[model samples]
Target: MHFQYCPHCGKKAERKQIGDEGLIPYCTQCEVPLWDMFTTSIIAAVVNECGEIALLRQNYVSQTNHVCVAGIMKLGESAEETVIREVGEELGLKVKSVEFVKSYPYEKKEMLMLGFRAVAEKADFVLSGEVDAAEWVKLEDAPGLLREGSIAWQLVRAVKVIFDDHTLCSQFLRDYVDLPYMKGIRPEDIEDVSEQYVTLFAEERNSDRVKRVHVGGGSAPFFLVSLIEHKTAPDYNVCMQVFRYMVYIWETYEKEAESIQKGMAKREDFLYPPILPIIYYEGAKSWNVPRDFRSRIREGSIFEKYLPNFEYYLVPLRDYSNEMLMEKKDEISLVMMINKLQTAEDIVNFRQLPGKEIEEILKDSPEHLVNIIANVLRAFLLKMNVPVPETERLTDKVREKKMGELFENMEKMDIQAERRNTALEEQRADEANVRANEAEKQAAEERNRAEKEKKRADIAEENSIKLLVELCQDLGASMDAAMQSLRDKKDMTMEEAQKKVEIYWKEPTDIPEKKNSPNG
Candidate 1:
């Protein structure tokens, strides 16, 4: 067994066991166990007088010959203290102050390394035994020399922070987080944190001042109210407050002011005064009004006659330049008015072009131009009640003329198609008649050839029968008997029998001479 000291508590730890692998230790004094004991180090990114950085060469197996500077933190020493002490001992250079940059967790040895920026008061090369060599290198070339996961890379990032513009960071924090938080709170109630900008509006004739109120509770119910005095009429002072409240309610609730200003605009109506303006003043917090008739009167005014004139008080802020506003004016105006309407039925809806038409439009337009058009159309369509997919405003007569032209083209196409089909049908009928005539001519020629062949066969048969009858007559047979024999024995026709009789007569038999005299 071997003994060790606890790095955290600095107490002698008893070695519980030792094996072929390693020794396991537990501290009896601190009542804690340490596993995988490792050393932690701090790396300083020291910049010299010439705006150059300091680097050290490594020789260990983990990182060989690559440049990095790191030293183990001594017991009971803070991370910053270790960096200052390490730079002095390693390079023999004095540093003025160490700025803590960041800490990175290294998994290889279960260690957390801290990186810091140290500015050198003076440069004196005094290399320690641990570092083979040290040199000042340019900041740009530092990344190439330093190994990944080394302290050198972290130092490069910290220096980049120093060189980066500060305004971008301020703007980023304000837009994403700070502005949203400030806007979330009621303007009058915001004086708790933003007291420098709050102000009171007083009556010109009387010293009595007006108040700003935050009514309702929870997330959805709250609103900000500002009171103002009537310029000429003293009795109408409360009425003026009602008017100001109407404006404030709409500006805050009805209008999507931020999105509209950003050029990606939308509109939504509120149950209370929908559109409210951002009022700028200084040093006023919380608003109060008469508890009895004034509050009831304000409520009644909102529900009764106040709804119709709400849009008249709504004013669009002129923060955007005229050119930008003109570019987005139709979209912004369309959205603003659509939201102001009591219901979707109040606004007129236009027929929208189909997707194919929209795609053709996009293909013809430039990328940026198309995107702006699409965004504007989308914002308008969102507020409208009807399913107007994509529509742009044009003169009514022009739209009607375009529709008429489209119908005319369709009618012409249909007529041309019908004429082409009729011509094709006529051609098909002519072809069919030609084929039928050729078939009939072939049949007639085949019938005539067959009749000629039958006539030639009849002539050959007559010659054969005559020769047989002549042979019989030469043997002294009677002509009449020979004819009757050929007819009966050979089944010959009458014309064949008569030819046989004539052939037998040429043989000069007694019966043949009597037959010729009687027949003549």
Candidate 2:
């Protein structure tokens, strides 16, 4: 509430500078600054055993969009109390359990909305007089029924993703194995034995441990235990916590060997599995502390031999940008990218155009994985308290694939990429054909030029022979002169020279005829 007059003394307030608060309404009589006050409320996504949400239709809030059960906080009541009371009063159903989700600030209503996921057994909802109607909406259908950016939608989405730790862990491992840090850890090598260890560690810890066995060729299988912890805030004791968990896992293995392996626990041949501890931090603050357990101990160098030394792989989501995550082209990278969203614009932009990585995933990844990615995106957008068209589009993209349209899209993309490759090959072939044709044309031109030169040489030789014969006849020379000239100038043999002289010499006519008669 904004105070124009001091409530204590009913004196008119004046604007006064207060330290770091800047200008504030100050009353001279009370010597106090009046600050704006807002109400607090609780918003809950009531879920049942069948994984359906109880969405209520309230005309006052929104006629078209549905809302979750929400109510103003009462005096001397905690936020959890408000959730239970509101659910009981509004829906007349007992909340089996309640989990606190993220808080949302409703600026328009001047209220802070604390979101919760309240699970209840499926039963008929007893709607209050204020509610027009209430229906059980499937988890997948909640986003469509509620307003896109409303608190109700956001809460429902959060609840949908909260229980999906197994899927999340599997996806993380699949992507994590590809990183260079986990050297030689291939996807095929990861064998999840989580079920075997779940019962052993359930009493001591709640977080599930993903135990994978790496079976090498003709060798004993090695056990790799992965402990993944996600922190939204910095925890300095994380190293100690990881160390304790690692010890517990080893202890569990030892006990299992003792009970199941017939006295192998006490044997020297017994071995403990290697544990890989990883911390995934998405907090706004930087995690600048040391990751090694030895670093957490004071002056551990002196006692290094006696002390344990193990380091955790820290995956700080803030250290990577959206561009960096997009390069990974995996589901976990997409999750990290969504976690890095700082504004509604960023969320909307990503939803609208998720980049090439998403296309790669769509084209190559399995259908269930695509569906999981779509749900992850929807959950992220809803948790961010803003809705973009991309969430619905992505969800529909997955559903369309299930209905065969999505696979068609993938096939279309594959065909387009293949066509581009084929077109390049055809272009190369056409270029080669053009070069071959040019070479053939040049060769034909060269052959024709050689033929023309040969024909010219033949004509010149014929003209020279005719001129020589006429000259011999004019000079009154005999056929012997012509023969001698053929032998000397043409470099012909005696027989060849005689033949040439007889054929070309028109016999120096009458003069050659008299010389033969005289000789006879």
Candidate 3:
């Protein structure tokens, strides 16, 4: 069952033709069923009293690749029991408490993963033969270190959520202990992992006013780790700004690489990690933002080729449904749903939220829930100068229907506002176009003047050359000697070289020679 070849006879597997299951793989020589079985394993994000999560690097995985404590589940052991045993065996650390986080069906190794979150009283670590080293990463920093989107990576995300805010952690775990990403693999594998996953280096570039977010992960010697955040709404000028951010990151890495190349670094290490830009947008209207920089330029323009031609992964979250969200129910999806509720024309459209969306809300902290509810209410009353009601308004679960009236009223106001704003925006756009045209015209005129001046200069130089040639013929002197005599006798400037030709053109005459006595 561990491998394709029979353990008994070392013969390859063949299709066993029987039963409703189509072509079950089996070893004919040993007469045993391979049955497409996968190894069952347990992985845990162990947290210590200091609120730091435990991570380890295995002998197989490179030093840079760190993961949570993980190992095979021995026969006849519950997934929960395995979590305790594995932590003790692999890290020599005792887990006081362990909670099931999620499960994942790993296709790469053909293993079934049961994820857990464990807590310990101490921060000490004694790594085993399987683990090369262990690090206790702070909960906030754990997401940044985890291999983004990997099973271990995803588990750490769920565990860290509880560490960040304990109130909602249990409630969230109760409903979403089995994450949606692990569907059909196991009944207990589901979770959300967006908190602290983004590690931004260019902190100064973005201000607090801008709600910037990044989510990304990748592997190995030539690994690429990009800090990507989700952005919503359509911003026409956002492309150039986003491109600039990417350039800054690339340039930073390039500078580091250059240092290593030039022996400026103390170590002989060299690495240039790739960056990927991801845009996750969910707004009321469709994205009017240009997909590529070229799309913004006027069609058939001569300068099109000279303009920027870069592209990014634009995930239009508005296009997906809550059902789709169930399969990937996490912070990003929740954000998208919140945006959708703000946009729906009909209150019934709010039901587009996945069936278990309530569970998602209950799983988060009360403060978090309050914020979401408050935001929704505020989005509805954006036109009004309203003093937002206190958080207690969300106490009644039945208020969803009552909130429908508010949503409907907001839709009516939004429609009128949308029309007015659209017209005004169109007028402004036309004005901008007119100004651009005028500026272009001025630039063209300046270029035309410069071209004419250059032409005049060219003609003058040609005429002067012809005149000098004729002067040389009349003087019956070599051109070089005549020019040299003018410079040496009168100290003629190089600019007036042609002037000397003019003087030479006069009839050749013998003049009285005077000796320079006092001055010489």
Give the winner by lDDT. 2
TM-score of 1: 0.27
All predictions: root-mean-square deviation over Cα? 39.7, 36.4, 27.5
Q: Write the per-residue lDDT of candidate 3 for residues 121-146, one digit (tens) a residue.
A: 56577778878888887664565576
Cα shift from native, residue 150, model 1 (Å):
3.3
Better of 2 and 3 by TM-score: 2
Candidate that scores best on TM-score = 2
Clashing pairs in 3: 103-189, 178-189, 178-190, 179-189, 179-190, 179-191, 213-229, 214-228, 214-229, 215-228
RMSD of 3: 27.5
- Score each candidate by Cα lDDT: 0.46, 0.68, 0.55
Q: What lDDT would candidate 1 get against the real structure?
A: 0.46
Residues 1-520 of candidate 2: C-alpha lDDT, one tens digit per residue: 7789998999999999999999999998888889878899999998775657898989998989989999999999877678889999899988755656679998668899988777678899898899998999777777888886577876776664422334445556555555443444445555555445433343333243445546444244545455343467777777787777777668777887778877897788777776776777777789887887788788888778899999877777878766677776665676566567655445444554444446665576655455555666566544433235644654576545432222232211233444567678779988999999999999999999999999999999867766776677678888788777777776779898786666776632354434556658
Candidate 2, residue 447: how far the Cα is off, in Å: 99
- lDDT score for residue 274 of model 3: 40
lDDT of 1 at 352: 26
